[model samples]
Target: MKQTDEVDDLLTRAGARWRADQEAPPEPDLEYMLSGGRKHRRWVPALAAASVAVIAAGVIAVLPDPKTPTAPTAQAPSTTAATPDARTPQTIAQGNDDFLVKPGDKVQVSGKIIAVPGKTPVFCPPLAVPDIGYPPGKEPAPSCPDNFAVKLNGLDLGQIPGLSTIKGVLSGEATVTGTWRGGAIDVDVQTALKPLDHPAQTELECPVPPGGWKSQPSNISSTAVTKFLAAHAYQATGPIFRYPNGTSRGAPVVILIGLAHGDADAFRQAFEKVYRGNYCVVPTLLSQSDEQRVTNAIGDVMSGNPKLGIYSASGPGLYGGRALAQVTAYTPEVKAALTPAGLDLIRVIPQVRPVR
Candidate 1:
């Protein structure tokens, strides 16, 4: 069968299988191999069935070849912009995993080259003995999570050779191998990396907003200030959102904070004024000093209802801000999954509140 025809058939079967499922599949694992041999793993499971279907079709052809010099040819959805000279370095890595470049580095039997660091590449760190797992049913989104895979991020090649099998399930273990040629290690091989442990589950009550007020968008009339407030809404501290099947419905008190210490009151007031009438809003008179608290809050809200997200300006209370706009809104996985649906995480740089 032609590759395209084969892909279509595979996709059709995968689609049928997915539709038959009573509930949606949990999010796939998203693996990031960062530059400079580092591997950082952030588990977010909000993938749709279509995403998996896409993989099911062409997956067989996207695995790394044990005898080829390059990795597989699968691509993942990415938000990061391409960097100049991203491949100037000889090594590839995730957040921390690094591999010294031997001429024969291509000996791995099978693996995905997730990303090639601008500097030296490294091995992905072994999965640490985990004391905890992420919420159940949500795994990192993976382009191809099956079989031995190789996902190199920086460099691009037309096609890889020697890879024979590619599916959408992780093998959970990998091996490294190489060949010797021309004084350099002909680093070509196949191996599998262990699939991450299945994510766990946590149950907690969604807290009601401190008061029965929801932030109203109109409260902040100042164009600049309102933008900050409108981007985030303080909803009533009761349940406003839920999972698709009413499995997980949570009410989380949300606060959109300003990036700077000085603007805390403005952001708080803006958020409070807008949502107050509809829902209770919590006002953090003082900017938050703890990231763990914010992470906890975000995790809590998302767990209760995967579709509700927090919006805030870049500042000390909030996490680091890099995207142009400090103000953005989204649900943990809902917003991210919406990327395929055309919802982008808006970035708003906080300007001086326009004089009324």
Candidate 2:
């Protein structure tokens, strides 16, 4: 049989079964109709009973009164308004624009990772153009005024060789999540998309040196400088003689010591010891004016110019009767400048020296 015909046959059988299972309605009261009446009377009573039954049926059809109302079934939750499964990437450009990416912003930024000469292990590998200026008493301005820096914390750029020098500029695209921290935009590199191009060396304009050095002699005792240096892993084999006259140009001289690498505390301690020491051959011959000049020059080299390139400074110790300054050098510019100022410059060579 065809599908429709079979379905109809099955429905008909089911309906018949349903009807058979239901109880039959009571028979009509024919006895009441025949009793207490003549043949005409019986016919009238039957008609009246029929009319009453019709009225009752009509009333039931008009108004339905069920015993219990059914409750609405619980519906499954809709997934129509759920969060998106994918995020759209934001683009950031280089230069002096005020486009700041806040913490948790996923972005695609393209720029060159320019090498900062002296801000190593801290602000190294900053994402900027070369020759960024840092105004005195202010933060270093972004290389591209419109663009900001992305610090790749815990991410090794060294995996790509030659990335940390003036000879090379690492230009690439990175997918990152930005984090604003420590007054700068720090980024977590999700993916280094690609190396776009090699960076070319750009000329950096050095800031002009300040006029007239302000002298502030070290106040730290020689004992303190010696003790601090030894505690902080410095080879303190000095108090070495620089001036045979025990004075630098009629000024009492102290010992000069150079340090290749040390923090601010170490620098200050070394400066104080050398400045305060009375190691001059003729203590009376030592000139306070010469000592102040030497101290001022050291301060200028250490703090005045942002790019002075003297990692550490010490001394005004006696060297041939003239006050000399001992310093650790990472750049040639500092030596050139200090040498012209008449302060003897001793370059500290970096090496592991046995503790004395």
Candidate 2 lDDT score relative to the true structure: 0.28
Query: What's the residue-level lDDT of 108 in candidate 2?
Result: 33
Candidate 1 least-lDDT 10 residues: 63-72
User: What are the lDDT figures for the candidates, one per model?
Assistant: 0.25, 0.28
Q: Cα lDDT of model 1 overall?
A: 0.25
Task: Please list the Cα RMSD from the true structure of every candidate, rounded to 1 decimal place.
Answer: 21.2, 48.2
> How well is each residue in 20-82 modelled by candidate 1, as lDDT tens digits?
221323422111211134323321132221223222211211111111111111222212222
Backbone clash total for model 2 is: 21
